[model samples]
Target: MDSGQISIGQIRRSEHLPARIAAQLAAQITEGHLKPGERLPTEHSLSKTLGVSRSVVREAIAQLRNEGLVETRQGVGAFVSEKCARPIRIKDEELGDPQSFRALFQLRVPLEIEAAGLAALHHTAEDLARIDEALAGMTGAEKWTHQGVEADLLFHRAVAEATQNEYFAMFVGFIAERISHAIDAARARAVLEEIVEVTIAEHVVLRDAIASRDPKRARQAMRTHLLGAASRINLSLEEF
Candidate 1:
């Protein structure tokens, strides 16, 4: 692509613009449009060409650096890494689409299963109460409602928090927020009543297992709930 064709396009307020921009440039590197050791455009020039701020351009470059997609010298700008590229993260919006439901759940399963096991091993009385509060929020809410969705996210986050690992809490919070729309899309495709009912039962089982301090049961319960969610979304594991 030429400099003339470099616009990054209109960005949504809620989306992380720098991450989107970084993903775009990384694709260029992976696809060979940007050759290894070739200097990137100056941040100021990128800001002008992409119609984003200089800070956004800088952050995009920084993200690529962190991902090992690019390298920088103190006086020089960025260059594509000489090493073969790893698979880039699918953009959150893309992953959260109903069509990508299986992929989404596949990403969730391992992390959340470990989170559940740790929560079972580590949860205190207050942590248990927080989990129950989130459950109560869902119980009082109707299916497909915003309140219910938020409650559901909180339940997962509470479990992460119960693990007593700050990184787990942060990562779970990010995943929960990103997956909300996908979860809604899944519900839209299926029987909302059945989705709600089954979700409640699954959450209760997982929560009870955690509260009982059964790591094995907590892991199994979480796995069952996520797999069941994929089914509710009409996704087969084979799709992943």
Candidate 2:
């Protein structure tokens, strides 16, 4: 039972605790701090060291396992996979910084614009319905709360799904999840009523463009909405 000297520090309570823990462990594995075939510290040990519950440690390990970074042998323990391939990820800290946050939006803009265009060409009635439902949720959400953020994400995801491309949906979901905290932070800093009203209005325009089957207008509308969103957060995406 060699619990190697893994230097994981105690984590503060946060909404993304499991993800934060997973990212730290992934970094260690990728940097060769944790060797291939080396067993990870026991869940109990990790919980104690990280100052989190065992369930949190378990969830973190599950995330690593899903990424092919760890293997769990029932009755034995979790070990680093023999061939550890690094997976693409956006670190939580990156979203907290202005430059990295802007960079991520730079990546998001083009993909979402293209998705909007394709969705305009391909979306079914059901897709439109889902988009409408999410929009309605956003309209009714309490100011700057988690519910508002979730509804906003759902709208984007619905549009991505309307593109009829699984990969678009997957990537949109990934990017949205990674940047959600930033979105929340931005909303918290802005005039709540004004931001909410302006955001929902932009979403309406984009939605109508897609529903009308106007691909060009849909793309332009999406571009406008995204740019406006950045502006609301006090981020200038004009040069990007």
Give Cα-based local distance difference scores for all models.
0.77, 0.82
Candidate 1 Cα deviation (angstroms), residue 31: 24
Cα lDDT tens digits for candidate 1, 18-131: 667877887777777787887788887787777788877876676576456777888877877786643244566577465674555677778899999999999999999999
User: What TM-score, over all chains together, does every model reach?
Assistant: 0.60, 0.68
lDDT of 2 by residue, 36-152 (tens): 988899998889878899987886786576556787899888988876353466677767788888888888899999999999999999999999998888888453576777788
lDDT: worst 10-residue window of model 1: 1-10
Candidate 2 — worst ten consecutive residues by lDDT sum? 82-91
Q: What is the Å distance of residue 182 in model 2 from its true position? A: 1.7
Candidate 2 residue pairs that clash: none
